[model samples]
Target chain A: MEDLFLKLSAILTGFDDLDPKLGSLYYKELMKASGPPFTALLQTFSSKVLGHAASTGHPASADQPAPAGNPEDLLRENIWNVMDFQILSQAIINLWYTATLKLGNVTWVAPPEAYFDSLLWRAIEAHPPAVSGGYFGYWRYPPEN
Target chain B: MDKNYDVIIIGAGVAGALIADKLAKKWKVLLLEAGEKGRERVELVGSYLTATAQTLGSPYKPVPAPAKNMAPSPDGTNDYYDQPPGTENPMVFKSTYERRVGGSTWHWLGNCPRLLPSDFKSNTLYGFGKDWPITYDDLEPWYCQAEKELGVAGDHEQLNGLFGAHRSQAFPMNRIWPSYSDLKVAEALQGAAQQWSDFNNEPMVLFCTPQARNSVPYDGRPVCTGNSSCVPICPVGAKYDGSVHVNKAVANKATLSEKSIVTRITAAKDGSITGVTFIDWDGREHSVSAKLVVLAANAIESPKLLLLSGLANRSDQVGRNLMDHPQGEGLCVSREPLFPFRGPPTTSGIDKFRDGAFRKDFCAFRMSMGNDGGGRTQSPANVLNQLLKTDFGASLRTKLREKVIRQFRISFLAEMKPLPSNRVTLSSQVDDAMIPRPKLSFNVDDYTMKGFDRIADVMRSILLALGSKPEDLVLPNHSTPFLAAGHIMGTCRMGTDPNDSVVDAECRSHDHKNLFIAGSSVFPTGGTANPTLTIAAISLRMAQSIDNQLKMSQT
Candidate 1:
């Protein structure tokens, strides 16, 4: 479960060196926080990707080394193998952006850790405007290039 | 037994808080709010820091009431307001405002432009909408007072006769520095005179807009630091909100009851308001009687309460003539990097079209330049959604950064003439608390739509001048092209005649002598400016009239 979680995290974030321990922690918290639906999606994603890699002798196989190129490229290449994987991919991305899960009409807010670690801050290249991470008038300066 | 007070002001928004702060010095005052008192400033700032979506109402927790403007409920079960089925332009009439302790100012942008002289006499000048009983001159002193109270910062040099608002005093503080985007656009527009002309062919000029936020640390608040978060929450308390005056009112011996949703107002047979009844979150009812009652519960809720109580309806104008600054926005990429999304959301605007002979043909508008650095229009999330469909790896990051920095948006807030047909009425349905929900019927007339078309032409011209191809300009759709400025006004309109208007010059109801109404609800015509400054000025004037009347009764 931990290895699959690490591989999924690497594919989603496009980062190969993502700490396996951090991925395991995020996976455990996501399952505990979001419950059955999120875990079920993960299970399907693992089976489709890993099962295909084993049959086709792809680098994603457990017996072989991981792909050397961008994980996103590898996932994009094999994304069509799973049905509705794009929806699951977007759901995972939404969790990173809003720290929440939207199952149908209902939305469930993720835990505080997920919210604090959302990738939205890094994408915007600025801390939340309401709680300035710097002194007054710090925004007057250009953001770090 | 019901508690008695000298004065009871419904809604603890800016108007109510100001009135309470002023009148509480001599008269016993009670402020009733429908929402919670909200978290402390520090806690609220923290909540804003971690919010995934920094929407206007994100910092404050949702109050468990049927405020239709809040988050709309799914399944169509819980609604804040009820409109007739197939209402024309439902989105245009859909307004958003907070019902918390400080009311909508919790998310106001602090843009403080005074209404021009023609704004008060729109009927006489343009033969459309009713004229205000009071002129800019009558409210000029109060505008100064409101500016001082709100700690307005502005450049006196920018106060040309463009809007015809003469200021007796300079702003309380110096003007906030314009953002990089504002400077870039202003510089570019300076040379393009032929492209930016008004109806009379007068050259349109860009000037720094007067703002209510602090620029030099007046009133114990720090200067605005350009956090670009002025709308949702000002983390450093640089921008003014109703909480400042609410706190002052509390210090001056006014009792504020939060989470107290005012349900109905009682009036005597002699056409005088007697008392008010409110319900708590726990469904407990409380009543308070007062010598005078002021309904400051915004434009929507105040009228809803009147309709529910069946009071102040003699003129039958209690909920008629609803007005809001219907706005249209256009987005484009500047030829040069404007670096938007950096300073306060807006810092400058073009007031050339605020009033003119074009009023005979179409509505007039105030054009404002946005400065939020692409956070609103083209956020990283939106860019990623578009980029991820094609690009991968480092190319994705490169495209996102390049596209975001060049995005710019400009919006026009057009003045809509008050029509008796566009209104707020009580629906047959009721909420769980048995309170009637407000039903709004609104439509954008051809006059306003024509004005949007003209503004679109001007916007395209401006974008072309800023080094954009004509094809790159995005014009608003005329069929459905209005965004609610949240400047709800004219429902409880003030006028000299009692036949057509709901309130008199003093914002006192024509049917009830002691019943005064504050806030933008009493605005006869909301010129193209944002209505908060005018709301504050009129509220201060109303507070003075109430004070004088109370003093004379003792004599």
Candidate 2:
């Protein structure tokens, strides 16, 4: 993954500057590193920006802790998930903005996480307070007022 | 002869609902509701436009109008009537109360507090407001029964004059959990009570006010999620709507006739209520016979129904002594963000001044502060300014959103005593059905004002103690026409005698052997606390009385 990021970084940063042979070599390496389905560029962005917090392993928690289920653990996992998404999503959005400027239109820029983040935040505020204000702001709407 | 129903109950609010549920086991019961069952009303329920209804639009649509133009609404901007006072009668002005199957419960806050012991004998002790025929001791058992029946959740251990009434059972459920704001005010007042020790030293205690609303899973109902929007409907079935009980009664085999707007009570030659005549919304009239009749149509409508039926006119006090708790609103902003929109409507209250040492003229209690954020801004001038300032696009939305929303506010709900002069009467003008509309002529007396001022001072002091700035406080004036507190009580007051009042100790009307009244409308004086608890208590006793009467007639 690290090697793919380095190679993808080289291509995105200075695709015009690379020799034809070097550029083809880097492109082949990107394809191999990313595996099937997702492009090397998408994988690099997701791992660095969106998946970073989940990799850190702070789990999320449940909205309401009931006696029946492992409600407490559920609550914790939910919290981690929410925090992970917010931080990762925002970071990726920021990285995309920078990456897009350097890569130009020659390469695709993934949709910024800020769009999804804003939508989620709006929904959270509109929801009842009890549902949103769980541990670590899981499903927590940003303060509207 | 084929006998009619054992009891004919009117209205389907908490009072009528409970009584109907109890009586349906043996006696055939006829429950009359003016409106359809579970009808959705968008206005009362909040909307997405702001998640609170736009206050503008057609104000009323009662089969008969609500209390004509009693006073302008509490916000104090619009006239209750389309025209000035004399041009249109006040009774037919606008609808203040809900008229659907559950009645106003759909819009009620669901606070079910019991009246203080002193409130029962206000006339005897304070020399104001008529005394209840029954003592606090007499109604204690039934109070417990009512709490159980209504699925009340309260901390009985922290009740006022706890020893005054002996309960056979504990509350059906526990007290409601406090919102962050409820805890804050309660803590502040507890300290203030100690400071004002000279004012009788009851040590202003704060506890969760008992509410018909669920706090935990009870009787198949869900627990309250602290919606804080109890005044309007709870879209989630967590808060207790009176219709829950109405539905229970129907499940228990109680007969319900809806959309049958009752016009009058038809009596036999002996003055026994032979039947009731009602007109449907489609202009079709139908008469149904019953052996016994009950009037639980609330303070405003109950008396109007009686007057229309010509049942309780002998004393001329049928609907005369209408009363409501006069609120003295004191709004104060906090230095720290309280995040007001994140909790229950009210979770805690100060009860130090609920009774003892306070004269009849003065009454006071601390009401729970609400979350100030999230609800829409209805200040017309502010809305008008936005229209004048900007284009009607994204900028306008952004500006309106920023200006209208406030994240913090704490308000005070001071207590008021019921005076004889404050009342509901029939108006001169008739509606489409030819029945005179209900008129409310009420004012908060100087005594109530004094009590409010004193309480307001204390609240301001408490707010300051909690790091609020001097400029943060705003005291709303109640002298100008504003709303009477939604807690309406006392019109068909309960007493010992048929001559002095309408009903007996058990809420049975004196004149008619079979007629009974349920709810706060039978209260002798509107107490400082919410009356839903006491109303539920009276409903239990009423059901028993009706049952006993049925047994005797069978023998």
Candidate 3:
């Protein structure tokens, strides 16, 4: 989940500056496409980031000990029960960056050059076109000639 | 005959409501309302965000539409009164009055004050316009009647040299306690009233203006909670609305036909009104008949109806003498925040400048304060956008919140002398039904501007004396032009002579024997006070005259 978030966040940031045609095309693609294709790519990246963080045995979730309650019961709660849309949006963005910092020491499968400045974010950015412009900088594009 | 009516009262405003309610108790009445009853409930009055969309001031908007004029846009989703994209007349001024049932009184701030004695004889003294057929003494009892119905609350104690108008009885309930901020400003003016002596110099005085809204529960309504949403709707029903009277009148057998837009009052060959033809909201034409006709549609539409009916040109004065209490805005700085954000609607007033043998053409008064947030009271996004105009990013939100909640502001109400040329007539453009629009031609005179400046200076000095900083002063300038206070008056003025007046002293039109004009339309001169009290008084007088006429026919 962590690696997946990181890849998604990075991909969104690349479109911060883009050609208008490409931006519009990307915006349209995101709307037409479904989750699984993106999900497989995100799952691979998140696992790498999460594995690196978990190995340190300092999971951010571990710092705040859970109250005396059944773990299974807590898991049974709906994902929405924990946070509303606004808080969830902020949390996703923040968590992605935090996971990146945690996994900074790991040797990424694709290597820093092949992935960091290139692959993951670019793929995600191009995957989704924005509607009414995207959140943050992902949807914006330079004026058409 | 198309049809005939005993009386045809146009407009469904407070004035119209009173006339219909009174006359219908004895004689047959036909009340015509151009707009629907629930318009304010669904369209004008809603959540702050939704209401702001319908209102003139909103955060999402930099400049909200002007209050009146203009038609529906191409989409027909919005009716921007100030400026429409493709209209013959584009410029807009702030005169927001609802054409719907109960009229603009639905959005009134509930500040009801009587016109001063001097206001009655302005023509005799200053040689302008016509004199009221009835005197202050004649309408005094009527003012008392209106106050009771409105459930006003006030000090009623003496102030300055004038004792104010004598109330037949005390306010329905005790006066509202002034807010801590109102108290501070009131204390400072206590001394100024004495210093300005001659005007304040009279032997008697009245400190505060009586209001139509409740301070404490009276009759059946609750006291005002100071929502400051008085210009729109009272969700709690604390303020008086003319519709409340209309409802009662209906329950007591007064016929109400909502969405009935009267096209014209058709008259017989003998010049007597035979009936009125109207189209309802669904485009169905209906004719109503009675022996008499009453026009209470307000200064603009009342004249418009008469003109359309061909009853206007007889005296050629139906829409000729249009007038309003020429209201303008002025600013003064205060050291301490007066908490303008909170209040009972308008408790105190300064009559220090209401009259004088000294100031030839000027009369002014101080109304309660209003909040002037530095554009922050707008929406979060809007404030951000404005801040983006000046600066960007992180600091914008913080600064916007601080500015949006300004708490101290006092407004002054001044009256412009009656100008005959400033009238409401027909424009070339037509409505959805092809009827001409009301072409309003008006301008504030230099004399009134000087009066506004002087009032602002006095207010500033008083604020300064009360420990306000001179640097925080908001001066009266053209940046904020004094818009119409919506207390439309004097269009069809009353006079002793038939030639100069549309209605005689009794509010009976000089030209049409069976036609009567009620409401502020017959006001000879409106004082620097809200016209509701004066309007109620005149309606009460007209009711008696109407009853007398009905009785004479029987005899």
Candidate 4:
């Protein structure tokens, strides 16, 4: 189930280079937030990828993304219109981008060590607000892309 | 804590720390803090990273109920402050202050643009706010002294004769080099300057901001590495905070009592300060005596202390004329990719709008270019949240990077006219220390409203000049109109006449000779500047006066 969660996360988040250790923590948190529904969502996500590969006449496992369809459309097809798939996908994105989980108004942040590891800073070509480790006046030049 | 001391300062903020550092050399000084000593830097950084809302004061320690044993933010949900009735929509004081040993300097943006000469005599020149008793010339020398003490870095040539105020010396260190985004905005504004001629014919300059953060290692602290978190927490000690001077004072043999909340300042019938009673960490009340007392407890807390003790309000001006450089932002996506999230939050601003002859009609304002990318709008975070709502996979990555990197913003800090109607008083609700919380009734006047209109008009012109549409400008909430910059000036104003003011030119209480009140509370009128540099200068001047008096008494 955890392996399936990682495979789905890679496809859903669009970043295949995510740290597996970080993925493990996120998987646990997703289940913690939505226990039975999370398990159900994982099963649905796996079958969609596997079934898509079969229908497309491509050899694919749950580990392999289909050559044709995007993750958003695959999820949105039959069962995805419901809010469950949308919320779960958003939660997956939030876990990678902000290292946070929101059930309602309350947002639960991951532990401190996982803070600087967020992909949000990576996407923006900037470090987090207070955690910049670069030397003096380094911002004078454009960030190294 | 000791029962008696040569001097007892009620707050351990920048003003208190500056005074303590000076006075501790000769007189035995005791600095009493309502909040505990500062928490670890990494702890604060971690808290800021984890905070969901990520408000200004969220990084500080709030578990022990923060200051005087209460929750961190006093203005969080209007639970701490008493806003009068009929204030449901129109007026609310949005700024808040932290109460740790370092005071609100912990979360200050560290942008220290000095007040212009016109700021000192606004009433005499513009017929707007009240004139300060002391002139810019009188405070000029002290400003230089303060820059050295605070280790201010600046490009002196850029702001040499800004609005007719002269600098006696070069800054202690060179200015923090402008960020790449700052240069891009500067180039855009140079093109935009010709268009601003219709609004105000004054030449718009993109001047590098003078800041207290070290450009090079001046004091023991390391140089700034563009942490870009100067407001919440400078992960490294590159930025200057009040705790720096507090350490200096303690090293010089001054006493510091943490988790000690001063409740009431006692006085004799003759109106001389006798002593003060405080509640300690264990909820034990203790009274301490001092030959001299300085109130560096910020604008709100200082006035609340005076009102609590029924002292220093002889002019009925203890808690009147509350003011803040209420700020508004104009967020825009630049035509080109100019990466923000660099160098201290802001490194450059326009001094042309800082002062001019237009003050007779509307209040003057300062224009600052934000390098933090839609700061109050919470750029990268808000952008990511919006993207994640529908976008995922490759599209998500592409949208997030494109939107955040090209994102830019320009914010204005406008001067608010002093109004007695906007004031701070004692609330019916009390803190854990049994002291009443501060109540505020704040609203801007027509003069400030007119200034906002001008600000919007000028912003539109600048956008057009940058080849951007006015529609791209994202302003603040019109209902609130402005976000509090936390200047918090006035309330206990200083003037020669005791009839309408709380303190004298020397910050000596008109009602009590031994009592001296420091901090922005003594600012009769704050111009468009951030008020910290001026706060340091005035506190240094007040310390000089007190030092001379104490020396004379010993002789």
Candidate 5:
């Protein structure tokens, strides 16, 4: 179940290096947040999308697009275009990027480690706000990629 | 007799904490707070990490809830005051203060800019707001002292006389290095960028803003690690907060009573403050006697207390002239990748607009360069919200990187002219404490609107100069134009005339000699700078006067 959810997150977030530890946390959180539909999202994504990407030996990358920037365009037309699947997919993607969930109409935040492990921070080459473990005055220079 | 306190401070905020620390060794001072005990740094950092709203007061929600008997101070999420009937811009007061032992500094961004000398003389120079009874020179030494007490990090060489504001002593530590985006913006605003606005042809200089966060370990605090969430909580105890002095005062044998809310100050028939009656967290009433009483409960609450007690309103100036620095922002994409969301929210700002002959027309404004890209605009959400609109997988990641790397923003904080009408009065409405809540009557005048127009112009010039196309510039929002700076000043102001002001230059009530008030409530006319450092300086000076007065009485 964890493996399948992570695979879906990787394909959706476009970041192949999603933290497995955080992946488990995000999976549980997204499952609870979106309910039974989240289970269907994983099953549909795995059967329809993950199988093709796994066989290809590489997930979708900007270097190569599938259809309309997605390969075979199967992912967008079948899943991304479908409102129900798209909603779950977008929530999964947002959870991986920000580690925030809106449950019970209140912002349910992830653990501190989850905030630090956010893929969006890695994507932008910046650390999480207020948790910069970087040295004094490091902001004076451009962040090293 | 053994429990008698020489001075009993009303609120344990920055001003109250500093005064308590200064006099704790010499006198038996009692530091009273309307909220709970100060939380641990690590605990607060963890609370902030999980708080969904991530606002100034989010870290305190997990702590004990506010007692029913306590005066109200909440996180900046809901409306705390109501506008009078038929008030035009009833958007409500935007800034919020905390109800914690450390006061509102827990959520402050920690930028500490001193008011320019001209800021004190704006009334005489600009023919606008009233002049301060004291001069910048009188506060210069104290400003220097306050910088040391607050552990300010600043470039003495760059800021010493940028606008003719003198720093007699050097900053305690070197300036915080500007963010990479600051260096980029500084370069972009040079030469041809100066021509972007014919309105003010002067070159804009982007120097590091002086801040209370540490550069090196000082006063037993750790050095700053450039945590981006300085506003909500500094994960490390690098940024100075009121709790530092509150603890120091405690260590020096001064008493601290958290959740002991002072509802009404008891006074003699002679108009002299005798003592104050307070309610503990359990709602039990207690009164403590004091020779001297200090009101340090911020701009709004201090006046509310005075009105509640019916004391020190002989001048009828308890809660008049409420002011806050009306602020707004502009965002765009930079041609060069200026990675943001590091360091403090603001590392550098333009000093040119903070003062000028233009004050004769509109109010002055200070422009801050945001290190947090698309700051309140939420660039990460902006990308994801725009994401899956088209692409998924690798393209989404690539798009986020591309968009976020180039995100940039410039915020403008415009000065507000203090009007007697923009006041805080006691409301018929009562809080859980059964005390009258503060009813606000506030508005933005045309003078401030003109400053907003200039801010729009400056943002246009700078963004255009940075090679950003006109189409890419996300300018100001007209409907919700200005933002609340949280630098609330001028509710019980100080001046020479007893008839026009509540307190004197020493912050002693003109009507009640031994009664003193602290914090930004005493500011006569606010300039474009943040009020914390000035609050520290004035509070320290007021402590000296109180000590001298006590010594004279003993002699």
Candidate 6:
């Protein structure tokens, strides 16, 4: 679970060094929030990417010791190399951004906390306008870099 | 259960609230709202804060029973309004309104431009569409009263002669300061006008918009703090909404029953409205008898009710001649960092094309400049995904920052001509309460489309002058065309001819003497302006006429 969490976090945030504890909590919450089908999809996506990394002479196996240097770079490279992994990676990225698990036309709205933690806000450097941003006039200034 | 009242307003939106606030002082006025009584301002603000997709309806919670979501439904099924097969240009007819106590105003942007003098005389001057029963001069005083009531802020001098509207008084408050993007755009346009003759033309001035949001603390509301969330919800009560008047009406002794959706309008044999029947959330039916009935239930719902109850159809115009401001937008990246998305969603607009001989050929349009920088484009996860595809590391972060700061967008809302064929009828599909849903058939005619085509060029020119390349301007085409501006109008249009219009000069239905209608639904023609201010002004005028008639009958 920890390996899968780190691998998924690396794909979403483009960083493997993200706080492991926080990553694990987000992964657990996301799995619960996304329910069974989507969580299974995420698990499959992580294993495939990690398996590809293992074949590429990298120590990405769960039983193997933590690989030297950036594991995210290897996973990201494998993500772009494989077509299905790329699609799944994009879907996982979208899951963080929209906080929804969409299968065809059906969608399950994610919990508010998931939306609050969406990396989309972090990428844009601004909180959702009416949501968690500060008081009335806080938006008047450019978001801090 | 049956209850009696001096007057029963079918909606608790701005129109009904304004009318009830005035009439409740001397009469027993009842305001029936279809949805839940809205929460306090703070609760709405909180909802907006946590909302995942902060679209127009984000702040307010939707009613539990099936209703339209503001954003387009994924499966192309109508959630709010049902559009049947064979409806022309049905995709462009999308609109969503809150059924809550405050109605759509809870999600309104608070833009309050008055209709031009020519708007009332469109048929007489342009030889198309029906002329309004009343003129701008007739409603000028009422506009001032409405502005005062709504706490409108504006630069009066900038608005002078823009559309030939004569104001009897200045705005209630001074204009909100323009954002950096607005100032940069205005400056760029000024420079471009020197080189381009079209920019110097009459009625083409870019100026501060008169808005209903407060620029200063007035009427017990705080000044707008540039929340940039005005459309979905105003975090503070700085923006004017129907709830303000609704609360005042209740305070003035008007009775309000929320979650009571009026389904039928009963009338006597002589075509005089007797009472209305409504169903509560619990599925219990109730009836309210009134001396006078005012149907302020918005454009679609009011006409749907009339068709359902089989009342006010003397001329067969209850749900005909539907109109809305069909709009197209352009996105551009400025060479300089304009830093959009800091202030209100919009602060200034270009109105030179609002009126002219150009109307003889096609529709006129208003170019509203947005201040949200690239916020609209960048905020969407899909668009951001596209933007982030090129870079993966720190380069991705740099690209995001650069693109967001320099992005600018503007939209053109073209005035659509009223067509009887473009109408709202009752759908076969019924809700849980068994009320028939409204099915709309709408199409933007060649006249409006030509206007859209013309505005595309103007939009591109403005973007180019603002430092965007011709290739960089993303303009709409036929395949991906104008969207609904949510200013639904002309369904129950008002005019001098009772045979052609649903209501008379005073907005009193020709068939029912004691029945009145309010809101944008009664507009004879929708001009190139937002319609809420006009809705308020017309409601105030109707309230006065009703008061006078009641007093005369008493005497």
After superposing candidate 1 on the true structure, give the runs of residues whose Cα lies further than 4 Å from its correct spot: A1-25, A29-117, A134-141, B42-55, B62-78, B87-92, B191-197, B373-378, B469-472
Q: State the lDDT of candidate 1 residue by residue for A24-55, as single tens digits.
A: 66566666655575565555445455543534
DockQ of each: 0.25, 0.03, 0.02, 0.69, 0.61, 0.23
All candidates' chain B TM-scores are: 0.94, 0.85, 0.85, 0.96, 0.96, 0.95
Please provide, for model 4 over A1-145, each residue's C-alpha lDDT reduced to its tens digit, 9 standing for 90 to 100: 7877887777666678888888899888887778888887776776675453433434465666553575557766633466877786787777888888876554679976676778888888888777787989988899888
lDDT of 4 by residue, B1-555 (tens): 679888999999999999999999999999998877857877787788788767777788554453445423463637567775576324778778888888888888788777899899999998988999999999999999989988899999988898798898999999989889888877877766654543367656688999989999978999998888888788888888999999999999999998788888988888889889998767788999988899999898999999989998989999999998889887777778778886788888887877767788887888888888767766687888887776777788888888778777788998989988788898887766667888888888888787777787777666555555566666554454577787888999999999999999999999999999999999998799999999999999999999987888789
CAPRI-style class, candidate 4: medium
Candidate 6 regions with alpha-carbon error over 4 angstroms: A1-24, A30-75, A78-119, A131-145, B38-77, B87-92, B194-205, B373-379, B387-391
Candidate 2 Cα outliers beyond 4 Å, as residue runs: A1-145, B1-3, B38-95, B160-168, B186-194, B201-203, B373-417, B477-482
Residue B43 deviation, candidate 6, in Å?
Answer: 4.9
lDDT of 3 by residue, B225-275 (tens): 655456656545677878877776666566777767788887788777666
- Give the candidate order by descending TM-score: 4, 5, 1, 6, 3, 2
Query: What tier of docking accuracy does candidate 6 attain?
Result: acceptable
Error of 5 at B410 (Å): 0.8
Q: Judging by TM-score against the true structure, name the best candidate.
A: 4
Candidate 5 local Cα displacement, residue B226, angstroms: 0.8
* Model 6 superposed RMSD (Cα): 4.6
lDDT of 2 by residue, B71-163 (tens): 112122122212234422232222255555666666566777776677777778877777788877777888888787777888877774552
Error of 3 at B245 (Å): 1.1
Compute the lDDT for candidate 2.
0.57
**A14-56 per-residue lDDT for model 3 (tens digits):** 2233233322333233223423533443333233333223334
B411: Cα error in model 1, Å: 1.0
Per-residue lDDT for B1-555 in model 1, tens only? 339998999999999999999999999999988877867776776666555566666678652334542222111212466765575434436567887788888788999999999989988998888889999899999999999998888887678455677888888888877767776777787787454334677766777789988877788888787776787788778899999999999999899998788888998877678889888877888989998999999888889888888887778888888888887677777788766556688888888888888897899999988875443456656766786565543455556556666677888999887878888897787766677677788876788877887888888877777776666566677775466677878788898888888899999989888899999999888788899999999999999999998888778
What is residue B264's positional error in candidate 4, in angstroms?
1.3
Tell me how far the alpha carbon of residue B262 in candidate 1 is from the true structure, in angstroms, after superposition.
Answer: 2.6
Best-performing candidate as measured by DockQ:
4
lDDT value, candidate 1, whole model:
0.75
DockQ of 2: 0.03
Docking class of 5: medium
lDDT of 6 by residue, B1-555 (tens): 239988999999899999999999999899998877756777776666555555666667642424532222111236656775564644547767877888888778899899999999999999889888788999999999999999999998888666678787999899877766777787787777433243345324578889898877888988787767787788777889899999999999999998888888889888778889888877778988998999998898889888998887888888988888987678888887776556688888887888877787889888888876543444445455785454444445456656767778888888888999888898887766777778888887889877766777787778887888666678866677567788888889898788888899899998899999999989988988899999999999999999998888678
Each model's C-alpha lDDT?
Answer: 0.75, 0.57, 0.56, 0.82, 0.83, 0.75
